[model samples]
Every structure is written in C-alpha cells, then in structure tokens.
Target chain A: MTLILTALAATVTIVFRFAKQKTAEKLRLGLLALMYSGAALMWTVDGFAAMFAGEPFVELQNPSVVADDAFLGICVLFLGAAIWAVGLIFKKATKKAV
Target chain B: MACFVVPAAEAVVVAIVKKRADKAAKLQAEALACGGANAQTNTEQKARTKTHSGEKISISKKLGWLNAMLWGGTALLFLEHVWHGEVVFWPPFLTAAANPADTAAMLYEIATSGVAMAVLVTLVWAGMAIAADNISWVKAALCKQKEGANQ
Candidate 1:
C-alpha cells in the first residue's frame, strides 16, 4: 500500500511536470519531485522485499509488517514536508536574486 | 527504532537548510545595501519587484508540479492498493471497535491515511488548475522558436 500510494504520487508529479513546462524547470520544485519520487522508490523496494519473503506485500495476518509500512509511509510524509519547508525558506532568501 | 530515523534526518536537513537560507539572506541583503547609495535605491526596489514576480512564476510552476506528483501519485497508488486487496480494514485499524485499543487504532487511521487522502484530493484540484493555466506558454514558446528558425 505504501509503495502503491507513493508510486501514484510520483506519477502525478511527472505528469504535472510535462503539463506545466515553465514551472517544472525551476530548481526549487526539483526538491518536491525528489521527495515524492524518493518515497515511491522506498515503497517499491519494500514491496519487492515482501515478494521475496513469499508474500505479496505481506500476508494479511502479518500486522507487524503492515504496521512498519504504515509508519514508514507516515515518515515519508514528514520527510517530504521538511524538504518543502526548506525549499520555501530557500525561495524566500533568493526572492530578489532569481 | 527506524521510525525515528526519518525525523532525525529531517531535523538535520531543516537545521542545515535554515542556516544556509539565513546566511544567503544576510549576504544578499548586505550586498544590496552596500552596493548602492540612496539615489539607486529606487532602481533597486524596482529590480526587486521584477525579481519578485519572476520568483512567483517560478514558485507557482514548481508548486503545480509538486501538487501533481504528490497527490496524483498517491491517488494512483491508493487505487492500486485497493484493487490488490492488500488493504486490511480490520477492527482496530479502519473502524472504532468495542475495545479501547481498537478505538485508538481507528483514530490513528483517520488521522494519518484519511488526512493524506484528503490532502491528495485537494492538491490534485490545484495541480489541474495550474497545469491548465500554463499549457499555453509552452505552445507559444514552441511556435516562436519554429518561426524564428524558419525566418
């Protein structure tokens, strides 16, 4: 679930990038892109790991794995928020420069 | 244990970013102040306004993309998860069960995943708006470039 959600997030951003060419070219927005894409990648890897363990994204009975994934997904949200906050600060500082 | 890792990493990231932003702000302000006399201040202010608009355009563009990526991607992934039946709507997780523990779990789900879904939906709306607004500039730019090449 974590992987799937993050993957969708990544896809949305990519489509937005192409749809809005002018805005997509900025460096600050790159941080946002990185945050979502990075989280998606993490979830994808976790999914693969689950498959390796002979379960498709963990057996429904395994609360432990699901709990971990949920927590990780939450963490990814925080990380993305942090990156966004930093980017905004940077934007303000460079307001007149660029 | 690893849950703390993301927070720890974010703390460090925010701290470093704050320092850099502050330093840059101070330096840029100093340069602007010292590099010009009162007579040039008006021109500097004008320049600042120009850059401010430019910054707005830059930010709006990026914000649009961010909206699309985060919300859009999340939507797709969520739908996929639902289709896969990987989502467990158990007593403690998705609903307020008879037990207090289950109630807490239900609240947790409402707080996190529910909020995330709401946010994604909102961002998708905004992303569509911005993407639609900016679609024209791209076509214009391409057309102008082709015209220039032809001439």
Candidate 2:
C-alpha cells in the first residue's frame, strides 16, 4: 500500500509539473490531488477502525502507530483540499471580472 | 516521512502550476501588446478566445467540481469507514466477516488503490492540459509567422 501511494504521489507530481502552463491543467491537477488524498484518508480511517474493532491490539505493532498515521493523513488531505479550493475561488473571481 | 512527503509534494505541484499560469498569462499579454495587424486577424481572435476559454473551463469550473468530488468523497468514505467499522457494504458481509485479516487488508487495499487511481487521473488531466496549451501557443506563433511571411 505504501509503495502504491508513493508511486502515485510521484506520478501526480510529474504530471502537474508539465501541465502547469495551462489554467485548466492546474485545476485538473488540483482535483486529482484532492481525490487521491481524500481516498487515502478514507483508507486510513477504515483501516484503523477495522483494526481496533476486530483484531488484537498487538496486531497493530504499536498502539499509537495507526492513530498517528490516520491523524497525519487527515491533516494533509484537508490542507490539500483547502489550497485547491482557494485556487478555484481565485479562478472564479477572475473569470467573473472578465 | 509520509506526512511530510504528501504536503511537500502538493506544494511543489502547486508552485509549478502557478509558474505555468504566469508564463501563459505573460505570453497572452505579449500577444495583446503586439496588437497591430495581427490582432485583427481571424486566427488571432480565435487564439485569444480559445486560451481564455481554456483557462476559464480548466482552472475555475472543472477544478471546483474535481475538488468537491475528490475531497467530499474522501471525507465521506473516511467517515463511513470509521463509523461502520470496515463492513464496507452488505452483499459481501459474509466474506468480509469470514476472514479475520480482511479488515486490515481491505483498508490497506483501499489506501493503495486510491492513490494509484489519483495518480493516473492526474497524469491524464495534466497531459491534456499541456497539449492544449501547446496547441494554442503553436497556433498563435504560426499566425504571427504567416503574417511576417506575407510582409
């Protein structure tokens, strides 16, 4: 899972780098970023809930490990979404003026 | 490390996108400034409209929808996962519950799968954007070159 996520992150970064020239690309990249991050959050939360509800605490390897991971994931996801939102808003305001 | 990576990567992508936007805007301004005979040409008008329209659609409208869907879906799935405790849906309840390792495995599966999907989507979208931007630039440049040739 970690490997997959990392790969995806790398891919997204590269695409966004090339597409930066067009406003549409920015928005598309933003959207894609939000989607990926959001999905990550979902998986993290779900994983934790499943672990706590069904498995022994020892299975987690460390008690704080899962929670810490989830917390971090959520925070990052939120921040990305926020920035993307702001960009969208700016785009809109600019469009309205034109 | 994962935490740091995600945000840092996002920041970098955002920065690059911003730089591209700046360049495109500058090119546009230059095109406008060169307004003499070229500006009045049909091709010039079309290029101007196309670029602006592309910006409007890509950055403003499409982006808003993408962000909403991506973030909203993420939050919803996360909440559901938390609240429901990894049951996922109903049909597979028997299979889901039958295996003890299923929940953790499933979560892992989702986390990994979601990321992959996100990356794929991002790449495709970015590629399309780059192509469009280039096409516009090329069109404008060709028009200018044509005008020069005529003179």
Best by TM-score: 1
Q: What is candidate 1's CA lDDT for residue B57?
A: 32
Clashing pairs in 1: A4-B77, A8-B73, A8-B74, A9-B73, A9-B74, A12-B68, A12-B69, A13-B68, A13-B69, A23-B61
Error of 2 at B46 (Å): 1.3
Docking quality class, candidate 2 = incorrect
* Model 2 spans > 4 angstroms off: A1-98, B1-4, B37-44, B48-121, B124-151
* Residue pairs in collision within model 2: A24-B58
TM-score for each candidate, following the candidate numbering: 0.35, 0.32
Q: Compose the digit string of candidate 1's lDDT tens values, residues B68-118.
A: 344433433443344344333564322235567766765554454444443
Per model, state how many residue pairs clash. 10, 1
What is the C-alpha RMSD, rounded to one decimal, of candidate 1? 13.8
Off by over 4 Å in 1: A58-75, A95-98, B1-151
Binned by DockQ into CAPRI classes (incorrect, acceptable, medium, high), candidate 1 is: incorrect
